[model samples]
Target: MGFFDRNIFIDIIEWLPENDDLIVYKYDRHDNEIKNGAQLIVRESQVAVIIEQGQFADVFYPGTHTLSTENIPLLSDLRGWKHGFDSPFVTEVYYINTKFITDLGWGTPNEIMLRDADFGIVRISAYGSYHVKVNDPVTFLKEVSGVEDAFTTEMLDEKLMPFVLSNFTDTLGEAKVPALDLAMKYKEIGDECEVLLQTKFDQFGIEIANFIVENISLPESVQEAIDQRASMGAIGNMNTYQQYQMGNAMGNVGEGNSEGGSVNSTINDAMQMGMNMGMASNMINQMMGMQRNAQAPQNQQAPPPVPSGPGAPPPVPGAAPSQLSFHISSNGSQYGPYTLDQLKQYVAEGRVNKDTMVWREGMPAWAPMGTHTETASLFGGMATPPPPPPPM
Candidate 1:
């Protein structure tokens, strides 16, 4: 057609993507009319649509189509003008890209909240890419690429990104996967999100081909806490670790023995910690023994212990009295396992009180030292008789 021609008569109609990203393109037909017998070329990975006054007339797949009554029944039925053989028709055509669009990215623009078991509520962010393709040309044109000359993946991303993030956050939160375990569940989460997001995109005739979860990032504070937790191990064997610490400190103490101040200080500090651990372990064991007694089965057979008389049961053979060594609690620090003689000195100095907490071997639990038969005599002088009040 020449510039002088007022009306251009077109014979063939088709479209080659302007770029790889082009998803939908409108066939530009500036005042051009297609003769009734014009050919419509639809290529592979593309779908051609015919529109009459904003209404979908017909859709064509990969083939050469003649715009006639027999080939396009939808448009022919709408127009119903078969009287003239050389008549021209004015209509709009759109071509949709059906090829998979890969590497289209998506990410959470802001941190989303997730409830975690170990760390309670945690804030997290994630990013990944997706792939998609046009599933239905007619619906895509109406819902997504409406009234646009061309639609690219960049434009689609603007709409798809939010949908992806919405579904992704919902999926992750609903799964309630712990923040620490999120790394291991990335693939499972991605697969689920793809399925969920595809359902939402189906309305716009976009199919999600693939979704990926590259990395889910925890907050800096959470990461630091995790590092510290790893550094301070959930120590499995306290006994072994305590032994290692004591051994190492003793080696150091021996090396510094000539330096009197440093040597004594190291010995005191190391020995105090060792004593504290030992007493704490004993206290816990005592509490556990009481718990076992309380929970003992009621129907179980048991004989009451004999009182101290002729009927008393004999002590087990080869057993001897355990050494009387006591631990005193003062100012929240446990002091030495003082022998009976040393404890008498502590009582004389007014440092040990009748109500002070103390524990020793063969005791069921820690208690006021005066409550014990062995230690009651230590506080004998502090008790007074009430004979004068009774006479009154």
Candidate 2:
């Protein structure tokens, strides 16, 4: 009775948040009886909710309020008391900041398992930050309000982090973003994540202002495998690689002999062999630059004329010869210059569609698969009638 006597009048009931937080419950003498003439102060971007006997009574927004029977009808009804009573009342008031709370971190506690285009099934880890806000304080109070002196963002994060990652798994899988190309699709993934999380957040009276993916990474072993595959693809044909290495070795030896003022017949023979093979213009020039001035007369035959007739660019010396490969345009992306065999595989895999645009060497321009007579053969058995029995 002595402690309650001094708290009858609450002149100030305000919450000054230390940081922009999700929700903070305001304290008014810690559930003590608030006199009828007491003051309730709420600031902008904040909402004050009153709870009487474990039920929400009234809500105040962005203004000063006086505690009185007129505005306490809901409270009076919940408390089963008549209006204009002379006695003071007991209630709980919580202030929830509606402003955006940013820089909250979220991440997958466990590696995300996804199928990649190049690496097949691989595990990856991702981390990001997001901004959130409270949209409905009443619903938040009913669902997640903790009976503490103050409810900080940490508590919200404990509940939200799991929700975010769960939604991330579904959204990322549905987007089908390749792990090798995940970096390029951050914005796309983030946008989709926001949409995917909106419905769930709405249920808790929360709004996700922005969701961002800062980094996505794969396991070291998986990354190494991908790198090796890419290196092989870049090296192309093995025979061409051997020729290129031979030319490079000769070039280095020629430089060494000229520096020592000695003749290397073996080196000269290898250089001549590379030149006779119609090495690329660039490689021929590089090898010739290493030759000594006195040795120029020994190999005086003019360089072979570069073959150029616009059939297809001559196979680069020491490089895979350019082959007739088709470029596929699908889903707003140019897939590749796939060889005939690879194109057959793609068709067999059902990756090509009637509207798929394809172009190959000697074609003036790209045309739909169904429109090109030559490439149309790639899409065989696509609703075409079977040939009549021969001479039946």
Candidate 3:
């Protein structure tokens, strides 16, 4: 078309599959008519090449583009047509920037914190050219700030840091100690923090993945006291010095009596002394009895006299008898041949004397032959004969 033509038709041509093309529609401000077979030229924005043809053909590279027209039938309706570039859909990501961790008295930032501390403090920078694309552009424009600007790290620190610190401090304070000990408690505490941060971040559509406690400080004095008490308590019992001394003393006493001494000899002496005293008492009693018998009344004779016979001696007078004989019935049998000296021995032995029974040859029954002679009197119906005068 000529520059001043009014009846010139400018068609906006678009190619299939690759729309990166441009066709400029130039119109005449003053009224003018174009002749048949008028030639026109077209050019694109990116390339500097020019085209000459009867009908303008818009050729494009292998990409998307926009086309416009001034006077063609369907093309004129696309006068203000612009290219529609579909951007990646970006969901609103709410995170806390923990670059101010030192100022907030928290630990380092890590993936665990990023995933787990969704509503809690997190230190991060824009990653992988991540830009916000609004699904609800109207809501994005109206509700969210910085729509014109990118979501920067500084924005996170300025807007979210205070809320993160406040929430984190409150969470840490309210965090319960695990039911288990250190090794197990660390995992449990991390899990609990993750759950807590996830719940807090639910309003912003964030999910927590992990959490951690970097450092724990306990008082040195408390730890030392605990160690000392444990050490002392481990000693359950102790030995005493006095017990050792007592054991040593007992050992000496046991060792000193290795051989027996004069104890046996002393016991033998005491037994012999007792025997001698007993014998002397018996002899004195016998002598006293002989003297009393010698002085008895004639009508109360002490005993029958022994008649002198072959190889036998008559009784002695006023002298202790040399021999005495008696019999006793025991166990349904007659059982004695005791002599006067034998009687004295028996009396010393605490066996027999006044209680002895005698059976003379002419007597019908046994009689107690003694100074008190009731047996003789009961048997013979006569007084006991006086002892034959002691042998001279």
Candidate 4:
């Protein structure tokens, strides 16, 4: 085909004969133009322009376009003629929906479903879908694999699947519980995975829509340990909290007691009683001091002796005869002085020894002077006293 005879109008249906075939179009080649009744595959980069011929028009598939002075059928020459061609260029866009899967050991699937636990002992499952659309067939063929191999199961499982799983597991491990505990922390883990993978997969021209962690599984042993720890912590916290509450209650009670009248009365009574006890203690101390002073020994000068009367006889000489006195036995008797020597002589002569009573005229009752010895001549009695006269 000549440069001027090149057909520019291309139909997509005519160029692509096979379902999975890729066509390439170029704008500088003459043979790349479509011929009458001949099928051709076009490159995606080829640019075409419309042409008209006498009573006929032709559509050129994407391919090389040539221009020359030679009188040949070209797309610019066809004004009214109708033609059909197929598109050689196809553009596809790919979007990736990533999900994370964790590893749950022996009873992975069952435990994930049953307890719905999230821990290091468990595994996570990450799931994702690959969405693809044709964009530029030529560039896509040069840059990437064929369309059939674009979204192959093996490619997805190999390239992106491991990334999804690793990202998800790491994110789940780093996920923190919510402050309010209103929602599962896995949702936050999913969000973290989305952010991380978005940056990692940017070069692949793949847009990651969503990354999610469907389930997390825990081992039975880990679950049991967690339960035990929770129980112990709860009990300990309850005991400590109860003690604190009781202390607060007691403090409040004490405060109330002080605020009421009872404590006031008790305090007042204590103050008054203390004052009274203080006064009594002071009085007792004063009295003890006075008693001690009164009982203390006194130091006084001796008194002067009294002088003897003139009528009193002088004391006897060295022998000092005994001073004795007696009464008379007769009625209306008068007594006299008796000397001790005289009395002793009378007693020696058996005049008087016992059974004798004497009375004086001034005496009120008879006096029994048993076994008397007169030392003076005061009494002349050696007989018993007589009875008194009867009353009138």
Candidate 5:
């Protein structure tokens, strides 16, 4: 075709990207004819690029401009026609949208490998939304749009998702925040990720206006591990936790049994805890007793053990009464053969009461405190009245 035949006239030129477009149609026309006086319209948040022979000839911002030799000297010069051509000329016109596009979704394609404080190395998935806009339309067209007929949000999505994911992974790895804590630091993580992305986005003539992290997640197994760790911390003691698990298992067994389930397991756990508590109490008592004994007068002799047989000798008249020891029966159980001093302490602490049955070496049978002369001193304080006698 002749050079003149190749010319096509464009009397009116204008382009507005669709509401969803990110980098919209690069130009209204691709290397088409433009009449010298054609009206070119540019809208807000938009720029129009004019290309001649694959080279940028001119750029127009928002507003109306008449396409003429005076306004497009670069095109005229490129054509080597100083006087300007009377006939229509060929040029490529591209319109770039610079408005912020919000709510573009992004997510990691595969699990991101990261180190967790509690779980060591773990894999996690993250997803969220972001907003982007063309900050430099010229560079955007040259680098992002390239030869594409139209650069769309969808295209941008396809192109930018990898950057988003890879950058996010890198930022997360650098932050070293555990997966379990990501929820609490979502905004912080997102902010750091946004900062990392901004530099790269600037190179592409795009800006990330806002970034959001909707959620960060862990695999089921990892989550379960977290839950177990949490449970252990909450329980606060390994032995107690073992007992708790055993108790739960025992409870489940009871639930499964149609016949009368034994209370034995529950009793066993309670008894075990009680025994541990008693052992601790006994150790404390021993220590305190040792300290008291050490501080006692050096000349005072240690008390002799009470005689055990029927022919045992009587207490010496001059010596202080032998420290009497008695066995306690409480709540249908035998507790201790505690010394009178220990029993007095127990009474003061309300651990032992008048209603509690008592037995001693010389006692004919188990009897209540009010009936025992040797133990009556335990409740002699001028306080609340004595408890009623135990049932016969």
Candidate 6:
């Protein structure tokens, strides 16, 4: 009631803000004074700061404290108090929440230029959320909270957004994750960002409790390109895809539901078109360094069934077909019915050799070209007869 009355000053001070996101709260001490022996209550995940005039004087952790002239000599000296000559001192009491404030959002406010391997030069943006708390209240108040009585996560988000985006961009760029692989590397990038950002945020007295990367978005054109690539990947082997398309078309033709087979014929034509396209695509891919496995020809007629067992007669060479033309199996593939001359050309081209399997229409079964009479001439007759007797 009276300035000189010691009992009239504020007795105890504590804070419990109503707003959950409130990071800093200044206790209202309207017309009240911080005199000697005042009680200060600081709860868990909370910190109290005593700022005298414009300069910080003291900070209190989670505990009950009794303010005394001896304990707070700085406040007493700053107030110029000597004995009981001076009255209560004017000070600022701030409460900082040390609990993790969740759902604090961050994102790239603008598109960042990126040189992506798959898409070349492209622009990308990213978004994520994080949690934070005041790890160092004194520094936060002096450097960040900055004389503001009430501070909230929204205010903190505005300050940290640019830094978050900067770190995210650098981390993502350094990670060198391809646009096609960004979906798989979200966590990796986020983890790196969290590590890099902690170093920066530590000096500001804020701690990133957890960092997350929800999505790294690409440009619309780049996204469409990715989708197209994914679709192509889904198709797997182009040859197999073409076969599948043809199979579907043939299955439709077998249904016989179309009038005069018009639809069936169209389906067949489309399938053929797809096969041609697939062949061209394979060639282009090969030229572009996308090597594919060489597929065996599926349409080559199988060599006539071999007559097995030792009892089967080894047919006399003279009884073979008169045409001298034969089919040959080379490197696991069946080739044309070539004449002796054509076989010689094949030998010249290195497509046929001594061990090549050859079959003429009249042969009992396919026989090695070197051992078969009709084809043996291609590899130099089995073993030439010795001419030494004439010299002797």
lDDT of each: 0.71, 0.68, 0.33, 0.36, 0.69, 0.72
Candidates, ranked, lDDT: 6, 1, 5, 2, 4, 3
lDDT for model 2, on a 0 to 1 scale? 0.68
Tell me model 5's lDDT, rounded to 2 decimals. 0.69
lDDT of 4 at 66: 32
Candidate 2 Cα outliers beyond 4 Å, as residue runs: 1-8, 28-32, 225-241, 251-392
Over 4 Å off in model 1, which ranges? 1-7, 231-235, 242-392
Give the per-residue lDDT digits (tens) of candidate 3, residues 322-349.
3333444322234333334544443444
Over 1-392, each residue of candidate 1 has an lDDT whose tens digit, in order, gives 66424357788888977689888888888778877778899999999998887789889999999887666666666787654445677888888989999969888889998888777778999998889999998889888889798898899999888788889989998998977788999999999999998889899998897799999999997887666455335543445455445434433432353344364455467576687766754554453231222322234212222123344334335533333556655334454455566566556655455766665554545566677665666877533321364554
Q: Tell me how candidate 4 scores on lDDT.
A: 0.36
Best of the candidates, TM-score: 6
Q: Which model scores highest in lDDT?
A: 6
By TM-score, rank the candidates, best first.
6, 1, 5, 2, 4, 3
Q: Candidate 4: where are CA atoms >4 Å away?
A: 1-154, 173-183, 229-392
TM-score of 6: 0.67
lDDT of 2 by residue, 1-392 (tens): 56447455565678877776547766747545687767898999999988787777888999999877778798767767788765677667788888888869988889988987766788989999999888998887767765565778898898888789988888889888777788899999898889888888888889996799999989998776667556545755533454445434334332344465332453455546655544443343353242222311232222212223444333224522233556655333343445556556545654454556666544455567767665567767443433586995
**TM-score list, all predictions:** 0.63, 0.61, 0.25, 0.29, 0.62, 0.67
Candidate 6, residues 126-231: lDDT per residue as tens digits? 8889988889998898789888879988899889888888888888778887878889998788888888888988988999867999877889987766665566
- Which of candidates 3 and 4 is the stronger one according to lDDT? 4
Q: For candidate 2, list the clashing residue pairs, or say none.
A: none
Model 3's TM-score against the true structure: 0.25
Instruction: Count backbone clashes in candidate 2.
Output: 0
- Residue pairs with backbone overlap in model 1: none
Local error of candidate 2 at residue 298 (angstroms): 31
Where in model 3 is the C-alpha error above 4 Å?
1-105, 108-145, 153-183, 233-392
Name the regions of candidate 6 deviating beyond 4 angstroms. 5-7, 83-86, 230-236, 250-293, 296-392
